[model samples]
Target: MDTDLGYWIIPLAIIGGAIRVSTPFLFVSLGEALTERSGRINLGLEGTLVFGAMSGYAVAYLTGSPWLGVLAAALCGALFGLVHGVICSLPRVNDIAIGIAMMILGMGLAFYFGKPFVQPVAPDLPAISFGWWSDIPQVRAALEVNVLFLIGAGLAVLLWWMLRATRVGLTLRVVGDSTDAARAMGLRPALIRTCATAVGGAFAGVGGAYLSLYYPGSWNEGISSGQGLMAVALVIFARWNPLACFGAALLFGGAGALGPVLQSVGVSEGYYLFFAAPYVLTLGVLIATSSPKRAMTGAPGELSITK
Candidate 1:
């Protein structure tokens, strides 16, 4: 490939990789967004992501149905979230500390039960080839978008609308903003937060399914790549907006794809550094958006203390 042509290919490759790699980030960030919107934070989503990957892959391999695997993953993730929610609801309990404990519990359970699935080849999720119109192999391959990506994107829109336009959304916001206010309105804050956490966990689980059954298309202990933790920062960067989560996910995905794009174009001189693109991007975004005097402009009041 010509040197100049390689430069052009880099952008296209990153675009393609962004769409594919952003799915998990989108789902996880959305999950965290919902949780935070309801006045809770689940840092353990990293463990949830890994556990979901194991469960989804194991189920898919055993059942020969990838969709079923996705379902299983969602259910398992919800269970983890439920546990976290219940524990955090207790008086004087610290949500962040509990989240870390859950993370450890989730990882331990996954590693122990996931041993049987390390070598199994699960059924892979299907993709839609939007790039079929292109005759170029690279274009066609790059445009093969996953169905889950479309689903996640649609959910983002729906979530954004729901949070801003519905009664349920209002209730969640009230509860997140002030537990006393929720009580004044005759709402059960604990119940609401628990439900929101579970829903968030479900989304994270689906993201995990996408990882093990779609892109990387395999289940292993290392499947997550810290995407779960990065999601917390991404949610902060997105200001807890579901729609913004999608856009941030794409940006992070593009950063992650940088290394592969360079290698694809015969530029492997600093391949490893490129792999750190997503992490570097996260750090930079955090530093740029953070403020000492106030929270990021749109942060949930409950989490503002972290500022």
Candidate 2:
């Protein structure tokens, strides 16, 4: 590799790709963080993510308003979350099993309804031009930050504060810590978990909207690329911290961008290996952060994974 210009291209490409790709992971992981904080593990977010992509794209195509499509996607995602919450609240219901079923259902529905929209062009979300300072076209393109990314970033900060400094946050922590304590304090754990799960799903929906309405700029069966499932793992790596989820998301995004970055730098040999960067990073994080004998310290007491 050329030691001068080539090195800069790879970092720039990775930076740009990280910003673009991290949006979905940020949103999905944030949602999962909240859901897990409420003592529930919702694996169906993959389904919600895909369904949101379909709904967002279809609505944008029909209404000529990308923002409206985003709203529709969030609503659809919340509905999916509600379904999971309700089913899981039942006696002897397994949340993991229900989540898996919901994931399949979401995928099936999206594929069935999204066929017509496979080739249609939906209006894309507008982007902010941070690249104007740079004269280079690639640099300019790399710096074109999406408005949704800003929103997601702001949301991460807001969520972190809300979890630490609010009464609702305390209640959620209590419920997650112990169902008996919540009941004694007159807080309804099930209701709280349901609401948290639904809100989380809504956040994931917005992430899905970013995927189709901004980056990649389309909706299709292959649009998701396992990001939803990856987001679940991201939450674990983040140790259920909302702020940490945001950071973890960026890391995953950087990993995802590795292949393109390497290719951009003219490193053609074994470039395909870089495509697995995100998964490999995820595994590495799990191994490094997890302990065999002791549970992750920050995990919620009532969470299923802990049990």
Candidate 3:
């Protein structure tokens, strides 16, 4: 390949990778955004993600409709979130610990039910094509992106508007910023958190559904590879903004696909190093964004983690 061609190929690959890999991160990051905005962190989203994938694929296989599978995954994810919310509400039970426990439980349940779904060919999601205008094959290939990517972008904008300019968003922010203040205003913190967690879970489930129903339509032990966990980090990196989450997800998507792209081009010797790019970027962002002094001085007063 020409040197200039190689440079162009990288950008094209990045675009393709971003479109393909960001769906899961977008869903999970958005979900985590909602959960964190409620002053609770659902670290168990990893398990919720995998379980949702398994449940989505299994249900789609059984019902012959991918939409129903998406619904089933959302319901299952909501149930898990409910469990996490209820358990964490108990005195002396830390939300993080409960989240970890829920993660284990979700994974175990998924494995149990997913064993029978390892090989079934489920219905795949249809993509929307707008590539006819592109005369170049490479350009057309990039333009023919997944529909979920567009949906995710739309959701991010919608959520940002809702959070910044709506009553419900204000309530959630108040509750997240100060439980006592929310209670003073006669808003039940527990209720708000419960609702937020459930909504977040639903988003995560949809993300999972996208994984099994569209990207790679089959169940297996390795369907998801830490996309859920990275999404949690993504939320923080995005500064709890839904719109920012979209950009962050695309960045993560590019990082994730770098390994495979390099491998395809006969550069497989340091494959593991390429795979570490996303996590390293996440950590770097976290370090850059977090400051103990600033956190102590500026964090929401009722937020337990900062305290």
Top candidate, metric lDDT: 2
Which tens-of-lDDT digit does each residue in 1-307 have in candidate 2? 2235558777787788888899999999999999999999999999899999999999999999999999999999999999888887888999999999999999999999999999999999999999888678778878899998999889999988988999988898888889999999999899999999999889888888888898899998999988999899889889988889889888888778888778766787887788887778878878887788897888999999896
Better of 2 and 3 by lDDT: 2
Assess every candidate by TM-score. 0.94, 0.96, 0.92
The weakest ten consecutive residues by lDDT in model 2 span 1-10
Q: Compared with the true structure, what per-residue lDDT tens digits does model 3 show for residues 84-178? A: 87776777778888888888888888999899899779998777766788566765666667767788899999999998999999998998898
- Deviating ranges (above 4 Å) for candidate 1: 1-5, 291-293, 304-307
Q: Give the Å shift of residue 255 in candidate 1.
A: 0.8
Question: Candidates ranked by lDDT, best first?
Answer: 2, 1, 3
Q: What C-alpha lDDT, on a 0 to 100 scale, does residue 286 get in candidate 1?
A: 80
Clashes of 1: 0
Q: Tell me which of candidates 1 and 2 scores higher on TM-score.
A: 2
